[model samples]
Target: MAEQFNFSSPPFDLLRAAERERLSEALSVGYYAAGETLIAAGSAVPCLFVVLKGVIEERGEDGKLFAQYTSDDIFDIRGLFSGSSKHVYCAVEESITYELPASVFHQLCGANPDFGRFFQADLAAKRQLARRDGQNLAEFILTRIAREHLLPAIEVSAGLALGDAARLQLSRGADALLVRQDGELGIVTRTDLMTAHFRDGRSEAEPIGPLAHGPLACVELGDFLFDAMILMTRKRIERVAVREDGEVVGLLHLTQVLSLFSTHSHVLAMRIARAESEEELRGAAETLHTLIATLCGNGIRLRFIMQLVSALNEQLLERLFELLVPPALRSRCCLLVMGSEGRGEQLLKTDQDNALILAEDLPVEQGLALMQRFSEALLSFGYPPCPGGVMASQPAWCKPLAAWQRELNQTQLEGQPEQLMRMSILADASPVAGNRQLYEGLRQGLLRFAQEGERWLPDMAAAALQFDTPLTILGNLKTREEHLDIKRGGIFPLVHGCRVLALREGLEERGTLARLGALKARGVLDEGLADNLAESFELFLQLRLQQQLGGARDGREHGLDVARLSRHERDLLRFGLHAVKKFKQSLAWQFHLESR
Candidate 1:
């Protein structure tokens, strides 16, 4: 017998050791000459094939290659279950393959439910399985809040004296106390009592009710630890009241959430929030890469990681702005992060694509000087300057709100490609620091322009379909110089198409996935198509990240070498690109851009 092949990847990796051993013993080895047909179209798949030391090409009826399976690749799961094949598998080179008889394969599947589901499930289910595997490795973050030992919620009457409330909280070793007033509940933290007692020079005999804040941020006990972390991040609060069935159960603090993971996002967030100088923030920013690497290595979902990182990045940028700009001037300007950073999809620190929206009366020159210094500071903090000069340092991007509205009006009228692209970029703009109202005013103007400029929608959507999807008519990846531009072919179509739809629907979501959901909710997109687009977009992002991590040069658009990707990854890329093609077709139909 030939040596047993290792089943260490997904679908196969789900098999139990005993089952694998049994299948391994039943496996036989076979050799094929180059060009030999292993599995003919329409023929019953006799055995599950695992490429041992050769390459197998799966060709369609027209003899066009659809996929290639190299060493360690498994094939024919769908065919085996269906009892027939739609395509013929031929050896691309003289090859050896491990053959597991269909009978034994069935037996192994029957014995292991997980193994069966892995092979029989759809792509979405398989993705869920993969996520489960990742979650298993990082289960601490996924732990339910109810599972942790929680402090009892110390209760105090509404009219209790400050001194008595303080004594009760301290004596109970409680960090927070719940106060009942007018049949409503409020929370007073130890910090609140101390501030009222010492900082304000308040009499200890005064009632504590004034110190308690009503309508507190609270989370259900069933929420995951990660949910609590997000709540804390967004609310800018250190603690939240944990509720169980509408009753206060305990208090969850930021430190408690941080204790669950070693990534130290909580610590980084604190450092960014507390840093008063550029050097301190820079030190904190330097550790971000290590944290990202750790999270990625642990198989944490890229989406969750991106959210946490985006929040932390926003904090850093906000702190930097505060340090560089005067409080009075900062209040008059709105700092906006455009493009990927604004969309919260940035996995790596790219360039700074930012703008500043100044109040109508502010001096443009003064704003420009402050922005120039801010952009330079970002470069020192590791963000490269935008190659297209989209940063706030550019005088044009640092314009007053009225100037921005005029620019939008002019762009809508001109409809020039460059101007339209700029408009599209700004459509994703999100306020990072300074006066959010200024950004909101500018955004409302853009939305109104988008709504009234119906003719511009097609032109904006046309960019999405400009590049041909990197798939050939023969069902093969179309490549130039043996590389595929994943962004142009897959990412942009979904992103820009969704942006156009979001604009039409008046949705404020900046992220592509979130926009898809909003579109689905607004009935602008079918649920199935939305789900497919979301998965496809995620696939593209994952592939791009993988390509970048594989040592692609920074500061330039990167491409993926199809030959270098694993068979599974190649299949996913093909599926994602096909989704992009469908998305483009839909866009053309909706926008009437097909004739163009």
Candidate 2:
């Protein structure tokens, strides 16, 4: 027996002093030559193996390779539970493994719940644990909920005169007053009172009940503050009621939510909404970089940051469209945002990707001029023009609804690379503003196109497999190159793979995570793999964002320096790349890519 286990790594890293001692003392190094089978499928459980040298391959009952274990890689932890092997573990070469007795492992698991949970959980949960290992405070700060930031709602009776209600709201310094009427709750804002008095010819003496809006949009008190923020943004409201155990307890306003992070995102969002001209919009858009930096520095989670940035970008684009597009033509067309922006996964200001869909053919040369000016205006606002010219200004992207459908159908008939790329990009396209029907019409046609073609998916799926995972799982978790192009090597594969899966399943979700969840629900993708891929994709985004925030002024990076990361960060990167590999392999198997 020797002290061979590295307590510095994950799972072991989660254990305390005494727990580490127990593991260190029980660790025994054993040598196995090449082609040695340590455990066969259905065999009784043996000691857990932690590879210290060489490589080991995990193959399923069908003898298909599943995973590889290399230096510092642990395997067969499932033996701690069922006490039997479900896969064949064979040494790929002469290797040394730290054999921890099953009984000792169980004792250590019981001694450290966090350590135990990591081994017991699925890939998703395991990755989450690995990320939260030494970052408890950061996690808590980034995941604050509505309950922690509630503003005690000032409730006013419905019978109270509108004038008294308005005065009460002013005296209490509340932006909105809740009115309880007939076992229902309603909300009245200052604007509501003013509009009623001026526009409806009603005096302030009227009952507050008639002025108040009922069945208010609400979020659970325990809901994450980011989720509450999304609710208010989507509903176009200033505040939301917070409910606790089926009863309204408090309210969450825009200002209070924005206060969680000392950023000017709210102010910027308002400015975009109220902008009357392109110049005014450009002035507001200039502050976007500062807001992104502020939010990132405040330790906001990557998901929340992407969502908030996406929402603000949408508001900006919509406002610009309103100012530029004629009122007469606005009802005749739909504006769509495609690619990362459409997916709501973009963090920094990347290139512009948008399109316009008209309802029918109409003579409007002036409208076309405005559409062409859209891209130039966006470039002036600091968003770089799309390299491939996917902007709405291009005639290829700006077309009628029927023309868009025809192009998609033509892409299927003739497998052109550019057309395929457009389809892939269009898969993530979503309407930011305008006629929702036009967007739906295009989506339904695309869905039908996907449903009709069966063998064609393998060709569409080939693009997802174009890139290789950068980290080496067969060796020590090391990068293949000095600098890793994480976006292409990691993010693209995960995103495109998930997109192909969604198309095959006919899922309407445009976001990668949302599609993964939908695919998992339909049993089209394994739950563990789905969750792992999601967390891994997010890990890539987080890594890229960190790199971008540090430098990557263009939002496109030269590469990610793996050597610059901490031990924990480096480990997460390796683990995430492995998730991408698993997902890519699954896609290959599903599409029968090998046979092709």
Best by TM-score: 1
What is candidate 2's TM-score against the reference?
0.76
lDDT per residue (tens digit) for residues 1-596 in model 2: 46645676777778889888887777888899999998888987678888878989988899888778776667787755888989999998999888888899889888878788887775566666665422432453456464557766888888888788778878877778888888888998878987877888787788988877977998886777777776676556778998878888888888777665346566677788889888899998878877777666655666777888888888888989888877887888888999899998876778999998887764435446777788888889878888898888788888888888899888878867787788888988989877778898898878977877645778889888887777554433445555788877788988898888888888888888898899999998888888887888777887777777788556756378876765456656777787788888888898988765
Estimate candidate 2's alpha-carbon lDDT, on a 0 to 1 scale: 0.79
Per-residue lDDT of 7 in model 2: 70
- The residue ranges of model 1 lying beyond 4 angstroms of the native Cα positions read 1-4, 53-73, 131-137, 147-149, 154-158, 170-173, 179-186, 198-200, 213-215, 243-249, 474-482, 546-557, 561-564
Q: Which ten residues in a row have the lowest lDDT in candidate 2?
A: 132-141
TM-score per candidate, chains pooled: 0.91, 0.76
Backbone steric clashes in candidate 1, count: 0
TM-score of candidate 1 relative to the true fold: 0.91
Q: What is the lDDT of residue 417 in candidate 1?
A: 85
Put down candidate 1 lDDT per residue, 1-596, tens digits, no spaces: 44556665666677777887788788999899999999999999999998888888998899877787777678887899998999999998999998999999888888988788877654555666655444542786567898364776887888899999989987889999989888888889989998987899999899988888877788998887777887787657878888888888888887777767777777778888889899998999888877777777787777777788788888888999999999888789999998888998887778899999999888999999999999889899878999899989898798999999998888877888888888899989999889898987787788887677767888888888888899886556789987998888888889999998888777889999899999988888877778878888777776667666666424245588888876666766776777678888989999998799
At residue 325, candidate 2 shows an lDDT of 78
Q: Which candidate wins on lDDT? A: 1
